[model samples]
Target: MTTNSKYNFKWEDLGDIRLGRPNLGTNTHVAVYRLMQYTMRDVLEKQLGPDKTNLFFIDAGFKAGVEFCKNILDCTLGFDDFGANLADKLLEFGIGVLRFEKADLEKMSFLLTVGEDLDCSGLPYSGVAFCDYDEGFIAGIMHQYTNLNFEVKEIDCWGTGDRTCRFAVELAKS
Candidate 1:
């Protein structure tokens, strides 16, 4: 699928991620959601590992994954590059899950977890395949979005059982 096409959205517990012409002006909210997915699948998988089964834990994982990717994207690439500019790359290349959390809705602050499964699949599961899936998604994201060429010097993660991880994004000087 093309970037425009691949740029799909799945509002978990919402629907089948169908996309129609923007009934609303910019669909910024949806755009952000798509970016979150890209972050989780691309960046987090490398740091955390891939394995997508155990849908139950995926929700929590998405939170962690998205935050981690965002900090790096924001501090290193900036919102435009990380968001709009990166959209095509993200859709085309794909990155592993980065893991993220909503630090603040008003300020749009986020945190990335360091340890523990972001997906919170809870140790011991139905085959390690699930773990691989999450990791795989993250890998895909990396393949897709690394063009920005940003290095995440350090990441601090926290939380237990689907909690937000506090994070800091260190950038590489150009």
Candidate 2:
């Protein structure tokens, strides 16, 4: 119900991976990441219920996205260039293959897709969209770039029997 007051996350919390893991390096198996994610989801769902668990993931992801944008992205670029940079960074980080399906710069609305998404690309069909965190992540990135709140919804996901994750992003109504 309340946030912890003693600690706030900073990008520095990631630490020096090269210095720390000189032998292992930066890369790890995707399954290992999913193991932590799914297990945490399971415990959180049991304790907080599915809705709240999703919210927690989204909120955490939003924080991460904001930090990521601030640290990794070049915010000075134009919209098109920003998108291209973001796509490149996502791929470089092994996050996903980001593609813009549609864009309406005047309306601040867009449709985007991430293929081979880190979260749920190979997941079995579960009849539910499993990318609430991704939704918040995109919104956070957009917010950081444009200084505007966005409403991001995952419309298709591997959990929903879709091959790629699709999202609709629009400026949030004030």
Give the best candidate by TM-score. Answer: 2
Clashes of each: 51, 0
Highest lDDT model number: 2
Model 1 TM-score, all chains together = 0.24
RMSD in angstroms, all models? 13.0, 2.5
Superposed Cα deviation of residue 100, candidate 1 (Å): 16
Tens digits of lDDT, candidate 2, 18-118: 99999999999999989998999999999999999999988888887898899999999999999999999999999999999999999999999999999
TM-score of each: 0.24, 0.96
lDDT for each residue of candidate 1 in 107-146, tens digit (9 for 90 to 100) = 3333443333333223333322233223333322332344
lDDT of each: 0.37, 0.94
